[model samples]
Target chain A: MDITNLESMPGKKIVKHLGLVQGSSVRAKHAGRDLLSSIKNLFGGELTSYTELLQESREEAMDRMLQQAKSVEANAILNVRFSTSSITQGAAEIYVYGTAVQLEATE
Target chain B: MSGGSFQLIYVIGLLIVAYLIGSYREKRHYQSIIKREHALNSLPAVNLKTAPKGHFQHELVMGNVTISVDYFKRFLALLHAFFGGPITSYETLLDRSRREALLRMKEMAKEKHAALVLNVKYETVSIFKGSGKSIGSVEVLAYGTALIPSSQAVASNVATTTQ
Candidate 1:
């Protein structure tokens, strides 16, 4: 499905509003990884382990969101947004949400 | 060696190393950011849902960055709590990461042949919380929708480059 963070697609018409579709995931690093991060933090740069963890979680959440939109027969998802929050010291939660709708080419 | 004196010595050593290295890295990152931002500034990323009047198709674009405070900043931040005023050190940390995230979004829009990105948004997540305190690694994600012009002249580049 086509996804855009605009309220309306620039060159397409929304034929039907399928409704809101959303997905979320909560994740945390293993103890070994968490310890490694603390050591890495001493130097201060990108935390590859955490970056990879969050990236994977975000993709999973987006996949679930898309699946929800597809279940509603939406061909497009609009006004998409993502949010990440810490559940605990070592854990994070990611959420993906959007408005689902059917579209028609506006040529 | 007395415990108290040893602790002070270790903390001081950490502060010196972290301050020097962090300052160096931040300066280099800023230079790179300025150069890339100058190029992507023309892409016009905004939060308006309405696309400017044009014959264009819309595409979603995203950029994300993760940044952490150095040992020095965190050490200073812990002390800032006692005074309870504006934590200036953390301010720079957040500022750099936020702008970095936005610049990345603009770069994404430019690469996709989008003239402008609309409805830009951002989300911040704390990746690591040190001892349940005020120091942590945070991730910032900036996203938007790009308006890709439909004119054949401009469209030719995207067509030839991607497929």
Candidate 2:
């Protein structure tokens, strides 16, 4: 599982040489926070609702990513990336992706 | 005597304006903090590094992040209206970006089957700058090495399953 081998497996179309593993989670409830935030705006105060939403979404995304790694029989995953997109007014999509590789023993 | 009273009144008005301006800046600072906290917490913990088992090989892992200044600026402005001072929006942005980059590096290592990442470094590049009232964007890059544990090299580390 050397990081260098992440993209360099021998005889391994990346599509075939590498396994396609994925994890995804949809999060809602940010809209409620956003609403509260607008109200707080008039009075000029802290927005606690958004704070909670962000925390919850982050955890859910991470959990999904881990499950993906386990499915690939990969003890380790490298070069992970995260992207966020709005699914709807109150919901968001979080995606985590990386290369999965098999480990070899050292001499 | 009336003129003297008028002058005093003018001075008091100027002081009030200054105080209001200062308070506005302070409010903006807190508002940015709240926004950044939201961004950071919204991001999930991701590890992509794959652990290498025996021999060590040098590897490269890269992570990139782009942040919108407009979103951040508005958050700060909101705070400024409530409080007053120069808001430190840039710092919060930097912190969140770094965290994201680091997490990416770790995920790369986990994917490669590396035990850990080493010799990590970071660089920041300005991708865009605000013109007038428009917002800007900043990019952050993180790179690191992924290594595997030596213990796995031994036969004992191999997993055997009964059929």
Candidate 3:
């Protein structure tokens, strides 16, 4: 399925609007990575472990959103946006949302 | 030298070392960011929904990064608070994170062989949400649409030139 953050797909016709679809995921830092992160923190640099955690969580959320769009029989998602919030010291939450729509090739 | 002068020399040495390491790290990070940005300059990133007049086959692209402040930056920020002035020390932290995020997104677009990325957007969140006075980890997420020019658009010309 094609996804774009624009309100409409260029060179395509929006045949139907499928309303809003969203997915969210919350993940906590693994103990092993947390330990490594703490060590990295002492030296002062990028915490690869935490970066991995954030990446994983965000991807998971995006995947779930796509699944939702698929269930609605939408061919594409538009105007997508991502937001994140920290739930606690070790946990992070990511939310992704967009409008699902069906597009037809322009003649 | 007197004991007092010797102690002064030790303190000064510590400060000098801190300054050297701190500036060195900041410079290194900036240099890397600049290099990555230069590599991605050819791939246009914009907030427009429409493809650049003559483009086809658009896809979604995303990149994210979580960067943390080093000890020196945090220490300087704290010291700046005593005088109630702006905390320029922390400015680089956000700068690095945002640039890293964009570079990552651009890298993904390159892998997809995309010519440009449109409708780019950015979101930033502090990992230390509830904690006050401590911005431990900062994350920036960048997303956009990658467009590739249509081969079909040039197919007619190719056919004529060959004939």
Which number leads on lDDT? 1
Instruction: Please give, for residues A24-86, the per-residue lDDT of candidate 2 as tens digits.
Output: 677666455556544433232223443345345545765676676677676445545555555
Lowest summed lDDT across 10 adjacent residues in model 2 chain B is found at B154-163
Compute the DockQ of candidate 2. 0.09
Interface RMSD of each: 1.6, 9.8, 2.3
Misplaced by over 4 Å in model 1 are B151-163
Of models 1 and 2, which has the larger lDDT?
A: 1
Which docking category, incorrect, acceptable, medium or high, applies to candidate 1?
medium
Docking class of 3: medium
In order, the Cα lDDT scores of the candidates are 0.82, 0.50, 0.79
Summarize candidate 1's per-residue lDDT along B55-154 as a digit string, tens digits.
8766777778778778888878888988899999888878888888899778877777778888888888777877647776888888888777777426
Q: How does candidate 3 score on lDDT?
A: 0.79
**Compared with the true structure, what per-residue lDDT tens digits does model 2 show for residues B1-163?**
9999999898566546534543464457446545654644433232343433445544555555544333335445556646877556555545665765566556655555555565565666443334443224344556665554445423223542221
Ranking by lDDT: 1, 3, 2
The top-ranked prediction according to TM-score is 1
Candidate 1: fraction of native contacts reproduced = 0.66
